[model samples]
Target: MCSTKPIGILDSGFGGLTVVGEVIRQLPQENILYVGDNARCPYGSRPPEEVRKFLFEIIDFLVAQEVKMIIIACNTATAAGLEEARQRYSVPVIGVIVPGSRAAISATKSGRIGVIGTENTINSDAYRRELHRINPRLTVTNRACKPFVRLVEEDLTDTEEARRTVTAYLQPIQTERIDTLILGCTHYPLLAPVIAEVMGEGVALINSAEETAREASTVLSVSQQLHDQNPQPQYKFYTTGDTEYFRQIGGRWLHRDIEVASVALGG
Candidate 1:
């Protein structure tokens, strides 16, 4: 059965735009409905239970919108709620962690990989567990770059402070000489350039957004639910924070003008 319903994507804030961009590129025929919980952004520092609560709230909103699939684009949310969300929701729920782990596993030649994500995600050891589950001998280094989320959310990626922060956070991982580095958090891709510079040519940066989008495409194709007839796909953006700010940042990242509406989720 073919379904034309929009694919729902949720992130703590603007980070998921990375996934949105990939989805637009890979699944251009599919409509997209995105929610960014900016008002309660940076789920990284929050407890697992709290992050799960926020994730379910946003997922409930997307489910009510009748989306065919839901992508939890936030690493922390995925670490906190991916399994539960899959069981709770009838629609297919995809997470950033597994796709990223698979991609990193494929990219690494030395059997050593580095994962950089939020505090909660790193603490949960989601990527480490996923990578090890695939290959027990693989050396997985995990770093919690919590401030990187704030930098991307605040649109400070191009600043010197951002570079310094990136260097500081990645220094330990750099010394480890991991052959592949997973940009575990969706937001971390926005800082790819600086991270690349700091980590140098030896480390391959794996952006989860691209892999996640590919996974979404594969899932829809396998299930025969892909929207193949839509030539002009519609996109809807909602944010719990400032609409204009989201529009501005999202437009800059997406390289096109986007219409954003303010939405308040949960009582």
Candidate 2:
């Protein structure tokens, strides 16, 4: 793959914008092509095999677009399909879970880290596995906050109900004495305010977005695949569902409104 070719990224929906924002912040010179599987979004609740299928579909689509590197920006999809994507695709395929796990390890003071994500993610124990892979002695607790995604997707992150939901979902983790909490799902970062409020000032809320970008930088550097020239990065967004809603909510998520085109599945 050419070094100057756009880096491809995919998420279940608009949540991956968090990852895109971080990439933009740290690697302004690199180009990116992003896709959100909005039509069949919320991969969190699906069966592992189904999630894996969806992930491959998205990755296949990105590769068809001639992506140099691919980032799986969704926790659920990463849990389901990252390894398969790596094996199936010729290019490097990276996921958010490992980066988030490493960040949690570094951020935890008490060695007790809590991760809140979708039900499938928590059940799959992806975070727990990776966190233990790094430090076997650390204590890890994972909970699934299924509603947070809907809240963020609906732009209800700051609502009173959002506050209540956050408090309810995170109370158990707080009582567990976790000093670090991983926003395991990319979508969860948009609910950081509510999460922080409930967890209080003591716990460190780790957003893996920046860490994931760092991983990308490391991979590119180690492989001598870094893009040196300041080329204008092209960002194309395709939504399987409502392109208009994606453009609206997603533009807000990125703090830069742009056009969103429609993408078909199994085409």
Encode model 2's per-residue lDDT on 5-76: one tens digit a residue.
788989988878999999988888788888899888777677889888888888888899888899999888
Residue pairs whose backbone atoms clash in candidate 1: none
The per-residue C-alpha lDDT of model 2 at residue 69 equals 91
Root-mean-square deviation of every model: 1.8, 2.0
Full-model lDDT for every candidate: 0.92, 0.86
lDDT of 1 by residue, 119-174 (tens): 77788899999998989999989998979978987789999999999999899988
TM-score of 1: 0.92
